[model samples]
Target: METGKRVPVKAALKSHCWIDANDYQSLYQQSLQDSVGFWRSQAQRIDWLREPQKIRDTRFHPDDVHIRWFYDGELNASSNCIDRHLAGNGDAVA
Candidate 1:
């Protein structure tokens, strides 16, 4: 409920969560060490209309700043987020 507060992941997530607490730290370090390779693997987990040719185009300079990730990839975000869930969740609203 409070901004900037860290939530206890074990209490918030099911026991079956893909990444456990230790995994979080390891993954964070991996991302820092090899951002492109790390993100490339993560991107494959999603459905893409067309896979990305370029992974990122980020600029952090004060005057010119922008971040673009998977900009070349194409997919309907709505289908992935909402419509795709209906088949499994529609009849199991409990």
Candidate 2:
């Protein structure tokens, strides 16, 4: 009931087709329940030069602080954003 708080609610139909409320809730739940699997699935959407075998690296001690995600994954942002879209949406404005 408070502002800036996240709460799951039923899906609602809207003009936008990218994502809906229910889909977002489902993704949020999956992210919490299986973080590694959730992130792996999301990573599949990108073009990785070297696919990552590990999803997370949280091996840290009280004195050491280090965290990483998709470790060792290599990807080109220009290729993913521009090259990949050249076939269908090259002329389309971003």
Candidate 3:
């Protein structure tokens, strides 16, 4: 008799095509060390209508709660998701 249930591995679940298995440790370490810099680099991959001047902003109080990312950035969601891809993958099915 065999049980079909299986536990997922963390590495397998977090895999990325852009990152190599061997480089994962180093990249993880770098991210931990410089999260802001890492995220700034990652943000460059996206198309921003207006680039952010600040990475994050946070203010917490009993009356007011504010948390923001890319505070100065502006972007069109539809353009980023569909319009950008139309040129390369328009005919190809999603």
Candidate 4:
């Protein structure tokens, strides 16, 4: 099996601007050094029913590398997007 290719949407009206290459390179290096803390901070921004036990797991050879999320638990992405938002009394746009 092969990874799916993403289409290059150069002309699309993007909601966000691209990060500066130099800035991203530095940030990427820092993130690799402390991925758990970085990811934990990001996860805090979200309202999770059950917080993650393990922030990250990078135990694999590069050739057969695989990242496993919620290795100690589970999460429902669809429910979070739909149910949680509505539960918060947030308005929905048709």
Best by lDDT: 2
Per-residue C-alpha lDDT of model 3 across residues 1-94, encoded as one tens digit per residue: 3598765557766674566656888878878999778778878988999987788777799798998888788988898888998988989988
Candidate 3 is scored at a TM of 0.68
RMSD of each: 3.3, 3.8, 5.7, 6.3
lDDT (0-100) at residue 27 of candidate 2? Answer: 96
Cα lDDT of model 2 by residue, 10-66, tens digit: 356355457787899999999999999999999999999999888899867989878
Give candidate 1 regions above 4 Å deviation. 1-16
Clashes of each: 0, 0, 0, 0
Question: On residues 9-46, what C-alpha lDDT tens digit does candidate 4 reach at each position?
Answer: 46453436566557779768877988877677667666
Using TM-score as the measure, the top candidate is 2
TM-score of 4: 0.49
Q: What TM-score, over all chains together, does every model reach?
A: 0.73, 0.77, 0.68, 0.49
TM-score of 2: 0.77
Candidate 1 accuracy as lDDT: 0.87
Residue 47's C-alpha lDDT in candidate 4?
63
Give the range where candidate 2 is weakest over 10 consecutive residues by summed lDDT: 8-17
Better of 1 and 4 by TM-score: 1
TM-score of predicted structure 1:
0.73
